[model samples]
Target: MRTLAERAGVSSATISLALRGHPRISAATRRRILRLAEQLGYRPDPSIAKLMLHLRTRRPPGFQSLLAALTTVPEAEEQPYLRELRRSAQARAEALGYGLTVLRVAADAARRPDLERMLRARGVDGILLLPMAAPREFRPLLDWRKFSVVSATNAVLAPQFHRVVPHQFSNALLLCEELTRRGYRRLGLVMNSRHDLTVGHGPSAAVVWQNMLGGTERVMPLIFDPAGAGDLREWFERERPDAIIAEGADNAQDIARQLGLRVPGPVGFVTTNRSGPSVFAGIEERPDEIGAAAIRLLTSLIQHGEKGIPKVPTVTMVAGAWVEGRSVRAPSRAAPRKAATA
Candidate 1:
């Protein structure tokens, strides 16, 4: 410590705090100290660090370390995506020598007090917020200073902390380009307004960006109201899109059939969410991977004693991969022309 402090021209105390990512230390100084430490091949011994933590905390000898999976509802009522998220989080936490606990925040006014009391009593070291379909802000009632926290959902809008989520924009771009390569010229994206907003408008914007790149007439997105009677035939006749990208390829195929259009014969379809059967060519947003990444980030924050809302929150995005299905196939333009002539 003395050697590093002398080389970095900082007091030994400052060097110690900077190495531990203490919030009181300036970020610039921290970086400089870390760079110097790396250059000098200086590393902290884990055994000593653990011993120091034990001495400081004076935790019960048999107490098991724990991490919390914070959610809005119980696991049984959670959506399939959220269930996968929780499952993966639990697996990762267990592997890291910590038990995972699911705590659902009640919707009532007494939520904050009860939740905070339980967390405090359990001595949770970190928290992982599960993803939600609708955007939300973490309740301000709970004291955030107690534990390191991370959200796995982009739906969180306030008290910005570090988050892990799907790379929606890049995933949409990849899907669009792949569809174009399959000879889909007039491609259209179908999404409800709420779904568009929930994903931060990534899918809608991706389609528009792709249209600009090709200098082609932009096939305006089909934004339908979920509650209203969405007339797919009317939109198809007006837009004349060669392919449609939506949440469900099966439903898109059904809509085409109802309009006397053959799937993959005249119009191709792609799905964004592949929760059930792989009947559509689309992107698979891997919720499991997102959950694992969130746990990893949360553990790092806990290790470095990072807590509360970060001044500059960082987002880590996991890119989804394309799943090929029978709903979309290579376009046969020549065959179509021949059939038209015949």
Candidate 2:
């Protein structure tokens, strides 16, 4: 910085302000300072800036403030699951005497320079990424050593990074096993193929279903496509599965009716995520618990000045609960009869 300022014929403070693009510095002087800094190979130290910020800001005692960044494309609104997870995390943070700030990274901010600048300027101590539909391609862009980070879902697979997510594979296996125990042999899976491809969670569930079937032809895969309901109908008719495990109960019920199958009798259903008001049998991935755990981990890292990937990072898995509903029926129940006489 000294050499750059001398070469630019400006005071050291002027050079610092210009290099940082402070509004007080004239644009022409800023350009000159940047060019001189480049000639001298000057790089601003982030640690120094962090120390300065700490000295300037007088934080209240026992207060641990952190930034929870949600890296998504611009215009991404809060979905139901994300809203619930954020609420749980925020509530937990408050209980622990910490302040939580949510940040959304725009698509253009994925670039390295922009991301680093934003994080450093904000002085974020930690970050918690919400579940993303696809793995973000910005892992290598930022300096991970500056802040602690935790992904809310297994959708992002960064080795040696702490992750908190539900045990999806085990949940699927347990769901299938329970259905088999209840004498539902011919079971089928209905899911959105696009969602599966984006997150790789669907394939894990499929593997569990296949194992539960014991190499038999009792397992069927019925992928849903909004533009191709006719194809789905044909597949359902030909498969004729006695029971269906679907992600959404209402959609599954409607499809079952379209195939001339009576619910809880000729065809049974189970919801993968019981999101709506009605209760249904399925796995409840305890997202709220996962969110709270992530915040706790982040706090630990911040308190210890631990950053980047831990040398021995750990993964925490919260098992899903089996919720029983009226959609499923035991095989011993009598078959459905025609409409009763008036």
Among the numbered candidates, top TM-score falls to 1
Kindly list the per-residue Cα lDDT of model 2 for residues 186-294, writing each as its tens digit: 7777776654543346434554455454443555576665545546677777877666777666766777677766665656777665554553577766778878998
Candidates in order have lDDT scores of 0.76, 0.65
Q: Please report the candidate that would top lDDT against the real structure.
A: 1
Tens digit per residue, CA lDDT, model 1, 1-342: 899999988899898778877545755787788888899999899998889777755743333377888666655666666788788998877765678888776534233877788888988878888865456666574788787889887666677789898888888887786777677888888787766766778888888887767544579788877678677778878988888888655556666677796655667888776655666788888988998899989977875667787889998988887778777886455423111000
Report, for all candidates in order, the number of backbone clashes: 0, 0
Candidate 2 residue pairs that clash = none
lDDT of 1: 0.76
| Poorly placed runs, candidate 2 (over 4 Å) | 1-61, 71-77, 107-109, 157-160, 197-217, 223-230, 249-265, 310-313, 330-342
Candidate 2 lDDT at 298 equals: 76
